[model samples]
Target: MTLLDNLLFSLSTTLPILLWLAGGHALKRTNRLSDAFIHDANRLVFTWCLPTLLFLNTARSSIVDSWQGDLIGYAAIFTLASIIVLWLITPLFTTDRSRRGVFVQGAYRGNMGIIGLAMVVNAFGTEVIPLASLYLAFITLIYNLAAIVVLQAGQTRLSPLKLVSQLFRNPLIIGVLLGLLWSITGWDLPGLANSTLQGLADLTLPVALICVGASLQFQSLRNNRYLVMIASGFKLIVIPVLAVGIAYLLGFRAEALGILFLMMASPTAAASFVMARAMTPWGELAAEIIVVTTFFSLLTTTLGLFMLRSLGWV
Candidate 1:
């Protein structure tokens, strides 16, 4: 597909997510959903809906043909490199040690599960689905580690190992591991099991988007506008450029390169805010980062896609 075609297609698929966010705002304004309701919806989507989607997709994937170890390796390397760059640049944006965690978390964590998957599927095809799943797996693993380190940087009371353990305990991570195991073993889920999973998975994207929209606190954005903008720049500009450069250096090209670039260009993950609220004091900051980055990602992603196409990467 041409760059413009890819951009338009991406925007088409993304419209649903943005619309869902808008719907949430309308619902809240109309008193159809209380703030508590939105909070519960967020928890449900993260802990249940999203995990189900990951598990179903991974379980149904063809292990022999779908497993892309090299792609996973590249994704992991790119994510790690991004985290390091964000860490290095953290001091430039903030001097408050407590807020540093929020800054770094917003800068590096990406919405790989939702935005990345949607973009890859739109630009590529179903064949890229398995690759996206693998990419998500690697990104989730790396993000958890980076999040813990950022969240606990100055907290002497929190052990890194303990934080790591807590991250693994997350249902989404468990689902990923289980799905990988099932795929590797070539086990078919029973009809009942598949139905249950599919049902739960169906709720993942839309509900998550709605909750994300409703959870957006305008107050947070007003309070931390500069930090939000910095986070957006890191997510949309810095990361994509770094990922493309790294992919080129590693001899990656064509669709693989394009996919990696889009993945890196995605906005801050919704899970980052959830994790922050559950484990740290920077959750609101993370939410602001997500909102600002997501809004700007439309432009940055289009520009990245155009550049990738011009360079014959897609």
Candidate 2:
């Protein structure tokens, strides 16, 4: 396909999600969704719905057979590189220690569970879900590790044992682990159970998107207007370009390269705002970053996909 064709396709896949976000925003403006309901929905999405989706997708995919050692190693390296870069930059530019972690997480904590899977399915189809799932499992764990460290830094003492315990206990991580192990056992879920899992999984993305939209605080946008631009630039533009360049050097191509780029380029996670609100006073800035990047990705993602396709990479 031509570059224009690629851009159109990318926008088609991305626009539906954006509309959901817009729908949520409109709902809140009309008082159809109260803040209390939005908060509860966010919690539900993070805790139960997301894990169910991850587990169901990973369970159905041939994760063991499609497992790529390079995929894991590159994902780890990319995630660490992102964390280190964002962290180092945080101290130089920001004076508020409280907001530093939020900024760092904003730049690196991607909305993979939403945008990543959508991009993968649009470009490659369900056959590629296993690769994305495997990569998601590793990258997400690293994201949590980095978030905890940065958010807790220069403040309370961290217990290594506690951190380790939390990592393993993370519902998303747990789901991925169980899904992979269950896939290995080669025991299919009963038809009824599979359909039930699928039903729950289907709820995750739409609800997550709406929750994200409803949670956005415009006050945060006004407060951190410039910072939002900076974070959006880095999150949707700079990091993806740099990370994808590295992937190219490593000989990743086509869907693997495209999916990796999606992992890098997608908007900041909506959940980051949830954590930022719960952890520090920086939730406002995190929320602002999410809003900016989510909108920015609509344009950048299309362009990025066109460029990748032109390079014969995706």
Show where candidate 1 strays beyond 4 Å.
Answer: 152-156
Span of 10 residues, lowest total lDDT, candidate 1:
151-160
Q: Which pairs of residues collide in candidate 2?
A: none
lDDT of 1: 0.76
Each prediction's number of clashing residue pairs = 0, 0
Residue 7 error for model 2, in Å? Answer: 2.5
List runs of model 2 lying over 4 Å from the truth: none
- lDDT by residue (7-88, candidate 1, tens digit) is 6866775666677777866777778888787678777876888777777767777767766777778788777877877777
Query: After aligning candidate 1 to the native by TM-score, how far in Å is the CA of 227 from where it should be?
Result: 0.9
For all predicted structures, in order, the TM-scores are 0.89, 0.88
